[model samples]
Target: EPEVTQTPSHQVTQMGQEVILRCVPISNHLYFYWYRQILGQKVEFLVSFYNNEISEKSEIFDDQFSVERPDGSNFTLKIRSTKLEDSAMYFCASGRDSNTEAFFGQGTRLTVV
Candidate 1:
């Protein structure tokens, strides 16, 4: 199975630092999304990007965050300024369509110090 890949399963950064989390979504998929979980908190959707433009985005996706498909197979999320609350498990997911099943990556655990 061709799965979504994320680098550096764990990351430690000081508050206010810049961080870019990388992910390689499924090749044949059309929709990509970013979600996060704050330790024991419920999973929250941050943004959804399709056709090179943002399809939907939650309030959490503020100015500090940005996403881009740098290449055919690479999707990346960048945090211009990391906050203490930014520490969470960032997940990259992809689906064939809005109603289809989405597959999640193992997740990139960001720790802000």
Candidate 2:
């Protein structure tokens, strides 16, 4: 079945550099969300967006992180200044509606060195 796919499956970056993780979400879904799992911690919601403007974002999605559609099929997350604490598996999710279950991508492992 068609699903979201992320590039570079794993990324290694320095403590203070830029990185952009890419994703291709399900074509028909509307609501999009970004989540991060730090090793064994609970999956934390970073942000949720619909129609471009952010609908909701948690404290984790601070000024250093930004998300964008860029084009029709791609969704990207950019970390302007990476930190060692930012190492985690970042997942992109999509749902048909606001209250529906979201399907998550395999995830892009971000490892800040």
| Top candidate, metric lDDT | 1
Location of the lowest summed lDDT over 10 successive residues in candidate 1: 68-77
Stretches of candidate 2 exceeding 4 Å from the true structure: none
- TM-scores, all models, native as reference: 0.98, 0.97
lDDT of 1: 0.95
Model 1 stretches astray by more than 4 angstroms: none
Best by TM-score: 1
Tens-digit lDDT track of model 2 for 1-113: 97988887999999999999998889998888899999999999999988977899999999999999989678888999999999999999988899889999999999999
Q: What C-alpha lDDT do the candidate models reach, one value each?
A: 0.95, 0.92
Clashing residue pairs in candidate 1 are none
Q: Residue 32 deviation, candidate 1, in Å?
A: 0.3
lDDT of 2 at 104: 96
